[model samples]
Target: MILDAISSAAGTSSAAKDRAGIADNFDTFLQILTTQLKNQNPLEPLDTNEFTAQLVQFSQVEQQIKQNENLEAITQLAAATAATNAVSFVGKRVSVSTTQSELTNGTANWQYSAAKDADAAKFTIRDSAGKVVWTGERDISKGDNNFTWDGRDAGGLKLTDGNYTLSVSAKDADGETVTVGIAAEAIIDGVDFSGEEPLLLAGDTTIPMSSVKRIHNQ
Candidate 1:
């Protein structure tokens, strides 16, 4: 994806090669025109106007190829800048809009916001296998609410430490669905450059740079 993004920004994969081929062909054309002029009868010289126009056409093509090269350079520089900026995020904590969370040290935390006052909010915790291991209700307010789970299942039995997901469903007093947004916080362990954009490695979860809502100090 990263390569695709870069290539898309620069134009095409064969852009440089195409430009080189165009330059070589133009040089050969110029040589052929020069030879034809030298061999033409001086009594009726080859039409200079036609050759002049051909030269202009070749110049235009060369200019366009140069412009494309400049654009490709700019695109490469921008990608490098993004990667450099992403390096600073390492070791810092960030809040990302994601459903997955890591259960470390026997706990996991998340923050959710309610659009309106919800009479009731149900929280469901699912393992990586998509099995609902825990389900409970949380007393939520109209705005922001924080939730914490102690790595325990519905039966109060401790679960193994790993990655899990939290989902919240809320309803207003009218029983209509209440819009909710969920977010998870984690420390940026590293940056993954294997994608179109840098991915923040937060424990076992990979969060895209665009998904980060906020960054916090460690």
Candidate 2:
């Protein structure tokens, strides 16, 4: 009877709370069983099989509760480790796997790796609203290449400081399309842990820690 009562309570409580309830009920169950056995009629004895089954069920419930506690501990440990790692990125410049970068003051910078030398490589700049802002020839090398913008549109007009997207197109001497992978760099200012995963804050932008490709000196 007490086991049935505790089982119903276990359904609605958390592992820690349910575990305590189960323990209390289990103690009461043992006492009741002992008293029943002692006062039981000898002609019609209490069924040992039913008592054994109840004991086994209580054992299983306790084991499951312990396992739930362990899993919670592991999850909390993992979240703490991630927050620790994210905090270390503060003030560090990291290359993120994105085509977007912020233009601060009068300059913005990006980097890309070229698959091969492009005879007609060009860089295209787009504003936050996806409007074409600037386009020009890109002097790309075989390996690493860095591109910097002066926050100027194609007509030499200064543009406002904000986020912009960079797109690069390249072609070899034979006019075949070449691969150009764009990477945006930003100095992490802080960490936002409100989300499920930590996000690195760079000024007004929020970048996921998982998108970080390289960590440079502060």
How many clashing residue pairs appear in each of the predictions shown? 0, 0
User: After superposing candidate 2, which stretches have Cα over 4 Å from the reference?
Assistant: 9-11, 16-18, 117-122, 137-142, 170-177
Q: Each candidate's lDDT (Cα)?
A: 0.82, 0.89
Candidate 2 per-residue C-alpha lDDT over 119-138 given as tens digits, one digit per residue, 9 for 90 to 100 = 86888999989999999985
Residue-by-residue lDDT tens digits, candidate 1, 1-218: 22223334555435566666656556666676778778989898887777677677767867888898899899999999889878888998888898888898899999888899887689999999999999998657888878899999999999999999999888988899998999989898898998887877877678778888998877
TM-score of each: 0.85, 0.84
User: After TM-score superposition, what is the CA distance of residue 165 in candidate 1 from its true location, in Å?
Assistant: 0.5
168: Cα error in model 1, Å: 1.0
Native-vs-model 2 lDDT? 0.89
Cα RMSD to native, each candidate?
A: 7.2, 2.7
